[model samples]
Target: MARTVTPEIVAHVKRFEGCKLFAYPDPGSVNGEPWTIGYGHTSDSFLKVRKGMTITQAQADAALEHDLNEVADAVERLVKVHLTDNQFGALVSFAFNVGNKAFANSSLLKKLNAGNYDAVPAELARWNKNDGKVMKGLTNRRAAEAGLWAKGSFVASNTVEAAPGNPIKDLTKPETITAAGGLLSGAAALATGSPAIQIAVGICLVVAVGVIAFLVIRKATR
Candidate 1:
């Protein structure tokens, strides 16, 4: 089974990915093929985003956990070597951004599986492009992922600032709904689930209402 990433990693990913309440195009995606919403989430996620659609923060948070959990599961399936919490988190973040298929087919995966752990950071750096162009955002995200990867290795050093970003967000403040505690709560919950089945079915039920509400809101707006 895949290990869950710490809240810090979740925050690291959310910070770079950033969130928008409304649906928008993937800057990295050519022709804006897949619409995205609520923290760079796309049709590839559990909750599909479309043009003119908007999502509440609660729903967006749920979608993020669902997506991240899937990525963690993928990391578990593909990588044969052992990893520390930080190493695991770093890979999860990378896979989350690049897509499981891309990560699976990547030379980085091949190198890591070959036990060339030290080569991974450099391998990760090669992926700092999108649509045949190098993106500053992708470059920064890759650097962060590399830093995270290094931090968990024997090469861990002081220069590795604990991923650059805002501190972990407490989404359950009085300003938000109580049910929405799953913002961070959901990720932690799924990350620590005792049984393997919880990774899928349990997570969906937790956020099912949010999905329904989003549809209701979209219809009312139309």
Candidate 2:
């Protein structure tokens, strides 16, 4: 049976790609670049994206649905192994971001086909760089994809083991970082025993905590 892309996967792609109602040039492209509209829908789409073109949010959403369906179909055709919804969704998101050709040719796909599922996350993270620079957003997106890819398992759960230096283990969740920072700040304040230094550290910690809270709220609302 052909697998389908889930709504959760669609939302993940949308959150990362972001919706632009009006057509815009690819950020990394030079002049005369192919225009992208909707949720990263490009000129290659049948929807007729062009310079100066505009679309309603409803139109964008419709375009995204169409695009994801095509990508999902491509993923289904290319992947030979049976996949869970989460794995299929992760691959679709990857193909949506990197293009079907890249996804088809990727070492990630190769490893997946070879039943080396444990190596998939590292392979996904390798694509986090663009134009020879590492992008933090892509890194985060790939990590999320890896997490989803491993969500369910007949194969991944049973066969895959965390290798030494696994990136997943190294990924520090934001909440953990916040908690650790608080502890470190408290320790520093106590160790210094200098009133001025303690006051400065306290102010910095307050600002850091406030910023973290704001970011969390913003992400939640989004």
Candidate 3:
């Protein structure tokens, strides 16, 4: 819990593999509006703020980032209080999608408190509905969250906290590695159930093979 919240976490959460971070009316404009909340950027939606709120995009972005930091902090606290590492990450991922309240009232929370790990996966599936509809996005998120949540137990030492002697250490700054790693992990999770990931991975594999072949041919000529 010594790691503080940093811009890393903000960027990680704000990162949209196939979604837009801004609010607009057209799906073609930004990978479609979010399944639950349509309008504005993903970041704006995350903060539950309205577009055209009299702030510059930059200012609005800052506010949204700050709100995410707040959410992350809240997640850390909840993790400390009850959930395990995987559970914490899962909850964060869930919050990133369904917003915080869903996690707050989630049966996952209840099950976790009762030390019922087996119940988490099922509870996660129940969160896939929005406004009386079964949204595909929510379904994907729930599955990803279930996977992440199943990772391990609560290990607060992995959390960012202040130095024992340094009270000035801010809790709002996420560590660089944690932020970057979390973003990459999120991408991996999204990619697992998304065609986009397969496409990207294929592209990368192809590029790697090409580079290796080029190197091999050059060595033979030498």
Candidate 4:
């Protein structure tokens, strides 16, 4: 059976890759390296990415889906053992970040296929260096990926907690207030017996709340 990459996996990859609608060179390069666009899709023989190329959010999303499918296919082809959804997702995200070729040749894959599961995390962490130097972002990403692989869930550790002197008491900011209003409005509409309208409104409100909360937390940490 061919395993499918779940939506959760797609979300995880997107969170790390981020959305760059316009083409930009890799950051660590002195000269403009491979141009990347639309959720870390780099220019290759298969796709021609140019300097001024820009895409809409929908187009970017489509590109991400296509790229992720390719990575998922590669993961399915390479791994020998059965995997959980989270483990599959972690590998997909890793392969997406570090190219399919590197993933195929990695010690992580070797150990995973050889049934040395206990050694996988250390093997995954060994690839945290960029240009032969360790990067903090890469270190965190590897840890998260390894955690997902081992535990079969994404554990969020990115949030900034309250310090000794300062406290973060008010989570009901304007955006959250708007989200609450939306939730209430959806509930009211549901009470009116419009099932379709209520479902749509509820989904929109939930998405809104999620987006608002993510933005607020991200901004606070920064």
Judging by TM-score against the true structure, name the best candidate.
2
Candidate 3 residue-wise lDDT, 1-90, digit = tens: 523444533444454323334444433335443421221234344454344324455655666555555566766755435555455556
Cα-based TM-score, every candidate: 0.65, 0.67, 0.45, 0.64
- Consecutive 10-residue window with the lowest summed lDDT within model 3: 164-173
Per-model C-alpha lDDT, please? Answer: 0.80, 0.82, 0.56, 0.80
Report the Cα RMSD per candidate: 25.3, 15.2, 23.0, 18.3
Clashes of 4: 0
Tens digit of lDDT per residue, candidate 1, span 53-167?
9999998888888889888999999999988888889999999988899999999999999998888989889988877899899899999999988884553356875533221
- Backbone clashes for every candidate come to 0, 0, 22, 0
Find the 10 residues in a row with the least total lDDT in model 2.
162-171
Model 3, stretches more than 4 Å misplaced?
A: 1-64, 79-85, 152-222
Ranking by TM-score: 2, 1, 4, 3
Cα lDDT tens digits for candidate 4, 1-222: 667888888887887778988989977545787788889877765567888889888878878888888989999999999888888888998999998999999888998999876777798888889889999988988998888888743334558744432113335666567767877776776757677776776787678767766776766666
Give me the overall lDDT of model 3: 0.56
Which pairs clash in model 2?
A: none
Answer with 3 or 4, whichever has the higher TM-score.
4
Best by lDDT: 2
